[model samples]
Target chain A: MSPNKLLPLLVLLAVAPAWASEPAPARQKELVHLVRQDCGSCHGMTLQGGLGPSLLPADLRDKPAEGLAATIYYGRPGTPMPPWKQFMSEAEAQWIVDKLMSEFPQ
Target chain B: MKLILSLFLAALLGACATPQPLRGTGDLGLVIERATGHVTLVNTSSRQPYARIAGLGDLSHASAVYSRDGRYAFIFGRDGGLTKIDLLEGKIVKRVIQAGNAIGGSISQDGRIVVAQNYTPGGIKAFDAETLELLAEVPAEYAPGQFSKVVGLADSPGNKFVYALFDGGEIWVTDFSNPRQPTTQRYPAGKQPYDGLVTPDGRYFLAGLFGEDGVAMLDLWQPEKGARKILENYGRGEEKLPVFKMPHLRGWSVAQGKAYLPAIGRHEVLVVDVATWKEVGRIPVRGQPVFVMARPDGRQVWVNFAFPDNGKMDVIDTLAGKVVHAFEPGKGILHMEFTPRGENIWLSARDDHKVLIYDTARFTKQGEIAADSPSGIFFTARAARIGF
Candidate 1:
């Protein structure tokens, strides 16, 4: 194929996924806001962690949401992380855990 | 060599530069730079011959109980080893490691039995005070890991029964009159029964409900009826509270027919009238007060922070119903116990890795015994070993 003909195809392949995957910036702002209201009081506003482990990139930002939700539901023994199942519904923890894993400490 | 010497000198200078206050607050302020095999003591008074225990080996999380006779210090290591130290001689005379996991333990009034709570395979192992021999293993209700078993074994006011708090809100009452096969009573109460105490009257048993909201007042006198809710400190009334989210950690000071419930989340002590099951008064606290021990005189209440940095001990004059005085101990203050004479107070400084001694009368700092990595400490009036 001609070099000039290949250039257009390469550009389309490279930018298509990037543009498609990017969510509106407002959605990102809403997730950050949720974390601040839900977990910030105990974990600290910066998500640096206190009374609980840090939720930043180095700790749990990329971990599985199910595992994180399990920890929230079952709670860690001998730790302050009491099971939120009694207070929050299963779907509630999943939503917060999803937001936490994806957008926390951004 | 000279560079190393210079660095050592600089470090020493920094340690000496600060003016050592006669007394400070919390466990974090108590720093033991070196680890030792002997238990350290701080003379928090202006008296004579202040000596701290040292040289105790990597015995982190050792439960230290001072003998009632005031001559020896018994420390139970996490690995099931027990060290009997002669306080006067400042040496370990006896060391014994028996079978079982030691999660929680309390020395009896006569100091004849050391009841250690086992976690993995839930149960209580009774050991002879002097010999450290396994006397009996009292089977717990739940299986291993089912419940975070925290036992509270204290000689009843009558010295009759040794009580245990199993996981899932059950209290096991064992008649210690015969350690071989004591009459046991298993009654349901509350979740995560963390800390507990038997009232001097031996009528009602109080266990701190960590998972639930308040104190599970087990009526031993009426076991068939089970434990009644004398007070709930965690959640907002009538609503079941979730763990870690609401009022969880609570401390106890039971004496003179009153249970001083220090709810960490509420920052207050819920004084309960044992006989009537009523809320007497709310005593304010400084920070997350983890422990509330009644002074021997039964007139004052001493409270220390659970997470440190909450400077000062909450001293409550029972009659006045107000915080009379607050003394800064240090940052990592865990729990405090009084000497047999009730003149000295010993505190486990986890952050500083030292046991702090405070003068109860003067409410001033006396001296500090440097523990290499001290965790839990207690002093019993029934101790058999003493030095000097």
Candidate 2:
């Protein structure tokens, strides 16, 4: 192969390493957004449970999507948990509820 | 007309009687509650403010005990830091590190030895009262996982041994005559033994029960025998009284042959006759009544309050069994002790990080000392008596 052709190959190999180390930035952004919007004010940074129940995957893994959504919309009585019905639309609640129900303990 | 006059004279004589009812000797132990820690101290006789030294800081949640000579206060810090503070200078003269959580403790009559109980994994750590050196950590008579706190320490009379109480209701009677390898005996009571006080004569060892109302009286004088309960039915009622909470059983004062117990929930201090173990009287007090120190003369009882609220001290005329005066503290007050001369009251204002000094005679604030996390307070008199 010619020297010019070898230069192009080397450039591509160098760029590929950076690409391999890159994370799925969009997914990470979505999780952070969901936590801040849905759980941050009360349960705090990692959903380790603050004023609300611990939302760790280990704690919420067994609950169904309906129950999770209902809790988000209606809220837990006698505690600090308030109904998010006015704060979030049905679809928004469902989206975040789905995320919680899907990946928890971690 | 003569009969009427005689009746009036008799009533007047009763009112003027020297023996006050609630508690006789008003030995005030000032409690200083600080955020990082708490301390207790005795008010010195000098005009200088807050001059007494009791316990140092909130080491391991354990209480401090006065050495035999009243020269040093053996105190345990929150993280296994043991200290021997010079009562005169209020300085940590010696310190030794240990293992696990420490709570309340007791010292031997000779003041040569001190024992602090470890709350978690439950055991007793004996230390040289004067040197603050680790001597031995004796395992108390409790299960491996039992929640333990050293709550009470008392020296039985006849210069015998020192008795320390644990949360799981385990009592360790250790012979302190031998400082290094002390002999110990463990006995179970109920839930948590909050305060252990021996009679002035040292005939009986009374352990104040926190979970329940009455006391578990252990006959240390006759230990081949076991402990028994007097006033077992006390503090219980259909109305559900407020039992003394954390750092339970605040003031257990044995004077004039009576145990003055300030049961917090009931808002009343019950006087129990040690001989019969009966609830003789209930003196109504303000807030969460704790730490009833009898005046040495046995004429009045001084009561103090605890944290989260209720910061005040009340003087109860024992003969009258009524609160004569109430001192509103700017901060929460816990423990207290009278100066050696019995002229002033030193208080541990734990939350304030200051020790409050009160003129016992005038019942006025004299001065206060700034400190860090002061908790247990004590004073020494004539080197013959130790106050805790």
- The candidate that achieves the highest lDDT relative to the unseen native structure: 2
Model 1: CAPRI class: incorrect
Worst 10 residues of 2 chain A by lDDT: A36-45
- C-alpha DockQ of every model: 0.11, 0.03
Could you tell me the lDDT of residue A36 within candidate 1? 48
| DockQ (0 to 1) for model 1 | 0.11
TM-score of each: 0.63, 0.64
List runs of model 2 lying over 4 Å from the truth: A1-106, B1-43, B49-62, B87-91, B144-147, B157-167, B176-180, B242-244, B247-251, B307-309, B351-353, B372-374, B386-388
Residue-level lDDT of model 1, residues A6-71, one tens digit each, is 864564455453334444577556545435423432353355443245566457746775778787
Best by DockQ: 1
Q: Write the per-residue lDDT of candidate 2 for residues A55-80, one digit (tens) a residue.
A: 66568768775677777777655333
Evaluating just chain A, the predictions reach TM-scores of 0.54, 0.58
Q: For residues B65-136, could you state the per-residue lDDT of candidate 2 as single tens digits? A: 555545566666544556766544444587676644454466666666666655443566777665667777
Worst 10 residues of 1 chain B by lDDT: B24-33
